[model samples]
Target: MNLPKKAEDAHAALAAAFNTGDVNTVMSMYDVSGFIVPEPGKPVSGAEKFEEAIKGILSIKGKMEIKTVYCLQTGDIAVGRSEWSITDGDEVKVSAKGIEVMIQQNDGSWKILIDHAFGAEASLVA
Candidate 1:
């Protein structure tokens, strides 16, 4: 997997890898300590778990489109938000606005530390 040179490019890297349906490449974009919120309340960690979560999405067999909404960085850490969607031809498979926390590695490539897939959604009244 090719890591993004800038934090702003993380979403694009992920979208490209996801569009290719390569779980390993997608997983490679994450840091060893990273975790992902595949569901609003469920955070999955570990390579095996992350890979499983990614596999489920890949099964949708849609193309991923992600646009960076915002990104703030200081030192080696960055936080970003993005609006994303998956489409299979004319049908929308998934759509969401999310947040991601990333860290710049020693090599100056950014890796995802936390990916909250639904973080930008409006909270329900409970």
Candidate 2:
């Protein structure tokens, strides 16, 4: 599979990978040293942790939908905001907004550097 050249493509690939329940495919879009915050106040780093996080979400057995609302690229770094929804059959199991920071590699492909899936909600928690 080809890496994404744009931020939108990366998110689209992620949704496709999630729907397939392929953790490896999902992780491929991320930088090797990247990290994600799977929940409020919890940051998971490293390839092993990232793999574990993706596996946990895959276990939910739902279809994921991602919509990129905003993206701004500066030099080799891009910041994006997106909304995601996960549905199991007719029921929506999860719906949330997220912010992602992507870095363009030497090959001109983009990879996620920071994935804050909880977005601002994580910061507002008391």
Model 1, runs deviating above 4 Å: 124-126
lDDT score at residue 90, model 1, on the 0-100 scale: 97
Q: Give one digit per residue, the lDDT tens place, for model 1 in 30-57.
A: 8858889887788899888899888988
Cα deviation of 22 in candidate 2 (Å)?
0.9
TM-score of candidate 2 versus the correct structure, residues matched by position:
0.91
In angstroms, give how far residue 25 of model 2 lies from its true place: 0.6
Model 1 residue pairs with clashes: none
**Model 2 lDDT tens row, 1-126:** 577887657788778878878778888888859789887678899999998888887887779998988889999999988889899889998878888999998999988999888785545464
lDDT of model 1 at position 114: 94
Which predicted model would earn the best lDDT?
A: 1
| RMSD (CA, Å), each prediction | 1.5, 1.7
Model 2 accuracy (lDDT, Cα) = 0.84
Worst 10 residues of 1 by lDDT: 117-126
CA lDDT of each candidate? 0.89, 0.84
